[model samples]
Structure formats: C-alpha cells, structure tokens
Target chain A: MHKFANPTFFMKIANGIFPWATGISILCFAVGLPLALIISPPDYQQGDTVRIMYVHVPAAWMGLMVYGVMAASSAVFLIWRHTIAHLVARASAPIGAVFTALCLVTGMLWGEPMWGTWWVWDARLTSMLILFFLYLGYIALGDSFEDQERGDKAAALLALVGSVNLPIVHFSVEWWNTLHQPAIFGLKGFSVNAAMLQPLLLMVAAFQFYYIAVLVIRLRAELLSAKIRTARFNLAAAE
Target chain B: MTRKRRRLYFVGLGLLGLFSATALMLTAVEDNIVFFFSPTELKARTVAPEQRMRVGGLVEEGSVNKSGGTVRFTVTDTVESLTIQYNGILPDLFREGQGIVAEGRMGRDGVFLANDVLAKHDETYMPPEVADALKKSGNWHPEGATAQAAEAKPATTSN
Candidate 1:
C-alpha cells in the first residue's frame, strides 16, 4: 500500500486498467440502455415512465458512492500523508458533483410527472441537495488557497465533515417521514423484481467504471500541472 | 505510525463524530420537516394542531368522494384514518388504495384541509407499500380496492 502511494507508480497501474474500464463501461451502457428502456416491464402504475429509474437510481447511488470514496481518500491523505490520496480525492470531486447534479435533475423530471412537484425540502431530497453543494464546496476550496498542499488539506477536511451526510441520506426515509421512498435494496434485502434489478445494477456498474476512467484522466492532469510547476521553479533557480 | 499520523487520525475521527452528532440533532428537532405523518401520528400529540403539514397513507377503499372540483378522501395508515379535503384537481395518479400525500393545515373540526393532493409514487411504484405493511393488522379493509391497486405489475390494461 505504501509503495503504491507514489503518484507515478499509481499512474502506471491506472493506465494499465484504463482501457478495460472504458471498454466495460461502454458494454454496460449498451446492454443497460436497452434492458432499462425496452426489456423491462412497464410498471403497473407508471407505465413507460418507470424507465427513468434506470438513470435516476444509478446516478443517485453513484453520487453517494463517489463521495464515500472521496472521504475515505481524504482520511488516507490526512492520516498517512499520502499526497496521492489527496490527488485522488481532488480528482473525484467534479465527478461526484456531476453525478449528484444528475441525480437531482433526473429526480426533478421524475418527480414532476409522478410526485406532482419538481422539488421538496424533505429530508432525503434536502440531504441529497446538500451533498451536491458539498462537492461544489470541496472543488472550490481545493483551489482556494495559494499553496497546493494547503488547498489539499482544506478540501480533505471538508470531505471528512461532509461525510456525515452519507448516513443521513441513506436513513432519512426511515428516521424521518420523507416524501422520498425508502430504498428498495437495503440491509433488509432487495424487494424489487429481478428484471428491474438487473438493469439497474448494470447501470450502476457503468457509472462506477465511468468514474474510474474520468478519475485517471483527472489525476494525470494534476500530476502534469505539478510537474510543470516544478520545472518552472527549477528554471527560475538556475536563472 | 508516526506520532503526527496518530494525531491526524484522532482529529479526523473527532471532527467526523462531531459533525454527525450535530446533523442528527438538527434533523430530529426541526419543526418544518413536513414529510408525511401516519394517520395515528396526526391523531396523537406528536403534531401540533393547525400546524401545516403533509399526511400520507393509502386512500381508503370506497372513501374517495368527488363533488365538483373538491375531492374528499380518507388517508388511512390502517391504525387510524384522517379525512382530507382538497379543492383542486388531484393528480392523474390519485386512486383508491394508492398512497397519497396531501399538504395543508388541519381544521379545528379535525379535517385535513389540503391545498395540494398528489400521489406519492412515480407511475411505476407504490408508496402504500410501507402503508400496506401497517394495514395487515386487521382494521385495514380490502374491500373498496375498486381502484386498481398501486402494486407494480406489468401494465395489464390496454389503453
């Protein structure tokens, strides 16, 4: 684990897997889209509109899952002083933000036709919205400081603080009466029909692979920018 | 681990724990959380009178009566039922035995005077799933399931 903490070493591993991640992501989407929209049964209540669940549910799950990754990486960075962990956390913020936003926007589109409202401040919805803002906050704070390490530490701390929202988002339906439905897949076990479950799970895998592919690109960019900074500093010292 | 690394762990855990405590407390005490209350919760002391809120449960079978633009219905958690009156067009998804949420203030007469009434599930799912679990205790009448049940079977009706 310590050996893998070097960014260059990690990049080599990431690059090796990058092609596979993209290939699998595309394959999942290819199968998932049809499975979700065509093969799945029209719901007794929602009819064709139920197809939106394929996108909405996976996006919501990824948004939370990505944030969990970010927080854990931040903890690793803070405790072990692994700069690679900070880079990983930094790379994850925008992806998490986009996923959270997708979840919210898709939620609105699904909500309007179904729940008769575009938005509600119910605990689940509000907590999810906060998660979106937390991502934005992390991104902004990551770049706010003049020193990169200072920015990294600041963002890492925010990620840790924001993690409290994870459990709240998961349990808000049960702990408080929320307009949002309690999750179908939970510790009690999945009650959803297998047909719907298959497509949803596939879409979730697609989203996760998508995140990995994008994260590698982002991490590489960060590493290059750091390299450029070091080169310019070396040139100045010689002059 | 180095002493500095050990100290970092302690600080991180402490901050995480503090934030969780604050969030949990805030969620527990906030009065504006107008998410649904079971009919029994409405009948009891948890909710203050006339404080605007949303009540949710299955629309009792045979209890929905629409007259002109106003629709009157009973929302039952099976343990108890609350009568609700809404003076506007209900959403297309509103049906007997379907889970419905209505937002409005209660009256001195105990009726939930709803300004807005809507279905709780998207077209494909049912909210009364949670309510149905409560209804199995005996007071829940299966009669009046005249409205199609909200369960998510494949679309069986030809449009």
Candidate 2:
C-alpha cells in the first residue's frame, strides 16, 4: 500500500484499471436500466412510476457510499500522509457530489408524484441536502487555501467531520419520528419482495462499478494536474 | 496576523455571511419542506383543532369520494386515518394504498383542507418517518425482498 503511494506507480495502476471500470459501468447501466424500467413488473400498487427507483435509489446509495470512501481515504491521508490517499479522496468528491445531486433531483421528481410536494425537510431529505452542501463546501475549502497541502488537509478534515452525519442520515428515519422511510435492508431483513429486489441489486452493483471508474479517471486527472503545477513551480524557481 | 491574513479574514467573513444567509432562508422555508402526514398524528394532534398544515399518508382504499372539483379522501398510517379535502388537479400517480403527502391546514369539522396533494414516486418507498411509524405500529412486513429493498423504495406512481 505504501509503495503504491508513489505517484508514478499509482498512475500506472490507474491507467490499467480506468478502461475496464468504464466498460463495466457502461455495461451495467445498459443492462440495469431496461431491467429496472421495463422488465420489472409494474408494482401492484405504484404501477409504472416504480421505474425511477432504478436511477434514484442507486444514486442515493452511491452518494452515501462515495462519501464513506472519501472519509476513509481522508483518514488514510491524515494518518499516513499518503499523497495518493488524498488524491483518491479529492477525485471522489465531485463524483459523489453529482450522485448526491442526482439523488435529490430524481427524489424530488419522484416525490412530486408520490408525496405531492416537490421538496421536504424531512430528516432523510434534509440530511441528504446538507450532504450536497457539504460536498460543495469541501470543494470550495479545498480550493480556497493558497497552500495546496493546507487545502488537502482542510478538506480531509472536513470530510472526516462530515462523516458524522452519515449515520444520522441513515438512521434519522428510525431515531426521530421522521417523514422519511426506514431501512429496507436491516438486521431484521428486507420488507420488500424478491421481484423488486433482483433488479435493485443489479443496479446497485452497476452503480458501484461506475463509481470506481469515475474515481479512477478523476484520480488520473488530479495526478496530471499536480504534475503540471509542480513543473510550473520548478520552472519559476529556476528563473 | 499580517495584512494578508487580514484579507483572508475578510474573505472568510464574506463566505460565512453568505452561508448564514442561506441557512436563514432554509430555516424560514422549513414549513414548506415536509411533505405528508400520518393519519394518527394528523387526527389526534395536528387536525383536532383543524390546524392548517399538510396531511400525508396512504390514500385509504374505498375512501376516495369525488365531488365535482373537490375530492374528499382519507389518509391512513394503518393506526389512524385523517380525512382530506382538496380542490385541485391531483397528480396522475395518486392511488389507493400508496404513500401521499398533502399540503394545507386542517379545517373546521375535522377535515384536512389541502391546497396540494403529493403521491409517492417509487415503489416500496415510504417517507422515512411514515415507515418508522408503520414499524412502530407493527404493520411493517419484511420478507422475500431482494437486494433493492435494502433501501427504502420511493412510493412513486405513474402519470
């Protein structure tokens, strides 16, 4: 793991993985969407609108999952001072942010039909909304500082602090008398029937792969950007 | 702190000011953020005095009574039911046994006078709060659900 922290070695690995990840992401979505939209039976109750779950639920899952990854990477970067770890965390933020935004938008679109309102401040929704804002804040804080290392450290710390919300976001429906739904897959097991579960799982797996692909691509970009900055700084110093 | 630090301070202050303003705005619109009401809560606490607030729950089967432009219905969380009155274009997804949230206040005579009605958009999804209430009521059923059911499915319907 430490050896992989070296930028040159990390780049080589990312180069190899990026294409496969992208391919898998494309394949998963290609397969997942239709099955989710068409193949799955129109729910006995909800009918056709059940299709949005293929997109909305996966996005929400990724949003939370990516944040978890970021927080973990931040811990690694802070503890080990591994630049690659920081790079990985940095690369994941925007992708996670996009997923979070997608979840909110699709959720609202779904909500308007189901809930009869476009938005809600219910704990789950509110926390997710806050998660989106936190992403923006992390990015802004990362760019705000003049010292790049300072920026990374600040953003990493922010990510760590933000992790505190994940559990709350997850359990807010349970802990508080909330307007959001409780966990479908808890220790007690699933409340949903298998007909719906199969497609959902496939989409979730596809989303996870897509997340990894995007993270790899973004990591490469961050590496290249860092190299360019370093080269420019060296040239200026020489002058 | 030097002059550069002072400038940074100002920048931080500006950002903080902007953030604070946004928080205030969200706080002000807080009332508008919630979508539905459980029948139990609406009937007992929020609707008894006929408070003007949104009522959300499942549209009770056999309870929808269409009267010209105005539709009267009952929303239930299985434990309790709230009667809702709405005079508006209902969403295409609105259905029986589905999750719903309606906006407006409680009216006199123990009726929910809704200005807006919302339908659940995803299959198997309940508002987190509603789901909890259901679980508390011991009405929740968890069985034979596959992987997607791991997360709450939005209670969505079609147009």
lDDT of 1 at A68: 96
Interface Cα RMSD, each model? 6.8, 10.4
lDDT of 2 by residue, B1-159 (tens): 275456545545654675566557645764454444467655455334545566667788899999899999988777888888999998876877666778787676778788877664332533344445445655554322312333343332111
Q: Model 2's CAPRI class?
A: incorrect
TM-score of each: 0.88, 0.74
Candidate 1 chain A lowest-lDDT run of ten = A186-195
For candidate 1, write residues B107-134 as lDDT tens digits: 8788889999867762223223332432
Q: Tell me the spans in candidate 1 whose CA falls farther than 4 Å from its real position.
A: B27-31, B46-50, B122-159
Candidate of highest lDDT: 1
lDDT at position A81, candidate 1? 85
lDDT of 2 at B142: 34
